[model samples]
Target chain A: MLKLRQGQAAIALVCVVLGFMLAVQFRTAQDIRSSIPFQRIEDLSQRLSQTEKERDVLLKQVYELRQTTGAESATKESENIKMGAGVVAVRGTGLSITIDDSKRLSKPGENPNLYLIHDEDMLKVINELWAAGAEAISINGQRLIATSEVRCAGPTLSVNNTRYSPPYEILVIGEPQTLENSLKMRGGVIETLQFWGIQVSLKKQDIVDVPAYKGAFRFEYAKPIKDGGK
Target chain B: MALPLVGLIIGISLGVFFPLTIPVEYAKFMSVALLASLDSVFGGLRAGAEEKFDNTVFITGFFTNALMAAGLVYIGEGLGIDLYYVALLAFGLRIFQNLAIIRRYFLRK
Candidate 1:
């Protein structure tokens, strides 16, 4: 009884504060309930716009690439492009290269074959020239296409299924300096071929002629899948 | 007890009608402090029932306990730990114990 008499005022004051807290908490909870749905809608709309912006950027990139090649808008131009794909003769500023047998005779008891350029050697040169941004390449007079074949035939080399004896003249149409530098860079294809004692020469020209690919193309198994846009 | 009940009713009505704008960040602090305050009120009730309540102790404990609980929550938030759970569990347990003692006081045989 004495304790209650002394503590009554403080106890009432403390209870009032507690009750006030409870009421505020109740109102805050109600506010949270109303705000949650709005937050979710805001988040979803933000995601949708972000995805839409990404799609717009990709579509713009596709449009820019198509404009450069003129590949998508007109079918006749695209067909002409397909016809000219490593064929139908194209002329541009480029480099002319000649790779021949080594000046030295074959080593004692070593195969005479090792001193001559093989199909793989020619293939390596073609691949390197292409890597150096060569737009068109031909070995001797035979133009190289996607289906062109290079192989050994007795003492001669077969290109586009036609055999020709070297000194091989490879004509390439592209940025001549870049192509020449790519070859002349130490530890590259030209260096390796030179180390084998093979003779190699490169000349830049303002106008280089590459004959049309005369070989036939055969597609046996592959076909492009149709797109809805087409 | 009658005076406390009357004061609580008036406080609750004032809270409901006053429309005070407490910031969202302070909500966790307020909640933890409120839990500590609730524990103190229940403790006071239990102590009064047992004839051992002290005015000065109850008043000081009211403010100090609430502040300490809120400070603990703020520190825990800064340290990236959920230390409010410690205050919550401690106060929650004490409130229940006080309620049980207060109930026993009323139901004593």
Candidate 2:
């Protein structure tokens, strides 16, 4: 009976230790699943890849938007260039001037040529309008550009190589009051022309139209420098 | 038999209540120790059924086997060898053999 009782006590002690170790080992395995660095690293890598994909998609969209806006801006720039080159007709509030030869007979010893409107008089009037900030100008439907010419073609006046007899109509686009003041200033172009008995009339209009340059542009001697030049 | 079962239940509850934890690095040694203790328990049961149970042998074997298994695992890790597999195989076979013997003795009774 003593032997049996001793055996029972030993077995009971061993069983207690065995059960405690089993519980602890199970708990430790659970801890590893929750706290291990390898599992955490795997999760973080997955999130990083997802974020990178989203960034790449957004970058592609940005490039596409820039491409579209770039094309739109290019067209807008070319339109401005054409307007400044006098290749397009324009209209705005401005002044109109009509000038012709004097109808009165010349006095004795007076020069009759002074009573006629000369190309130099027209050039002086145009220059004054330009100085007063004319956006556009035309004479007898011929637009004035950088290459336009105004000179005496025999008895008639020539503008942009086209001849026109008086009375000449000059259309200018600008502030009407400013342009009128510029032309009518003391000892200005209009005052000089009126002293010679030349007929000159100035009128302010709500809208003045200037036609495009009709002459063709030929580049025979000049070429645009490549690579924006040195 | 009933007393040993009650002791086991008490031990599990105690382990559950305590918040003691081992380091992650020593987890392999703990597992080997656990296996060794389990093997000793079954060996003791078999000896008892055969009428040859010794309290001193049973208690000493329980502690020594657990310590030896843990030491073997530690040495295996330091040497970059898998010596724990040998301990595991030995313990697993012994547990089964002891279980079989206990089952036969109980069947005969």
Candidate 3:
């Protein structure tokens, strides 16, 4: 009887762990249906086209607004600056750079972080691109702005407060050849990342469209100083 | 036996109502661990039916088997080979065999 009673403790403990594992698996599969699970690939492509159409309509409205508000001479210049700052989605012939975690298995003594891409890697690459005259940049649908912060969130990267994982796609709108060359220059960001076994690829494209910033901009302390009709 | 069954019921209910997420990397380890635990439980059941169940053996096997199986999977992942499938196949077969024995024991009565 004593032996039987003792065995029961083990039974209970094992069952609890088993139940927990099963539950976690169920939750993971449900959580990672990879977003828009209900929508097929065809539906997603169709949705993309719909969003593009909407953007066109908004652009026309902006153009009409500028024409009617002809009193403000600074409007056109501010609009151009807004587009360069990633407030508006901009399309141009530029470059696409993709950085992903190395698939190679780490050596027994190697630090796993060496093979993984970090937030600093992103900041470095973006900084280099900007220096090369990238008009606008977006990483994994998270548009880069003056306030955008590239940070490490556990095993993932967070850009502008949105979390993303490896294989980060960076779309830049500028001179494609110049941007690509700057990134791949000897002793540059590409070589530095490659030294850590990080997979980096720069591809020049005929057209690269960058998404607009999706985050709200809050400025409490830095109030705009108006020239007041200079 | 009653206490253990009650504990199991409580566990499953808690798990169902309050499921938690683990890291994606640990999924394989969790699977193999669960399989190993199931194997131990069934073995214990078989031993009890045959009047040879040992508490020490059951409890030690319960913890060690799960951990060892999970460790093998972790190692295999590092080595670029999946060891969980092997553990799964082996544990799955043993679980069914032990279950069959327990079923037959009840049928004999």
| Per-candidate TM-score against the hidden true structure | 0.45, 0.46, 0.52
Residue pairs with backbone atoms closer than 3 Å in model 2 (clashes): none
In the order shown, the candidates' DockQ scores are: 0.20, 0.20, 0.31
**Model 1 segments beyond 4 Å from truth?**
A1-72, A75-80, A222-230, B1-109
Question: RMSD to native for every prediction?
Answer: 26.0, 40.4, 14.6
Candidate 2 regions off by >4 Å?
A1-69, B1-109
lDDT of 3 at A163: 91
TM-score of chain B of each: 0.95, 0.96, 0.91
Error of 3 at A74 (Å): 5.8
TM-score of chain A of each: 0.64, 0.67, 0.65
Q: On residues A1-230, what C-alpha lDDT tens digit does candidate 2 reach at each position?
A: 11233488888888888888878888878866765465457447745875897699789867766777778767866887887789999989998999988886665566778788889999999998887768899999999998889998877999988999999999999889878977875446786787666888999999888889989998899999999998
Interface RMSD of 2: 23.0
Better of 1 and 3 by DockQ: 3
Worst 10 residues of 1 chain A by lDDT: A1-10
Q: In candidate 2 chain B, where is summed lDDT lowest over 10 consecutive residues?
A: B17-26
**Per-residue error (Å), model 1, residue A129:** 0.8
On residues A88-185, what C-alpha lDDT tens digit does candidate 1 reach at each position?
Answer: 78889999999998875665566777778888888888887886668889989888887788898987999888889889999999888878876865
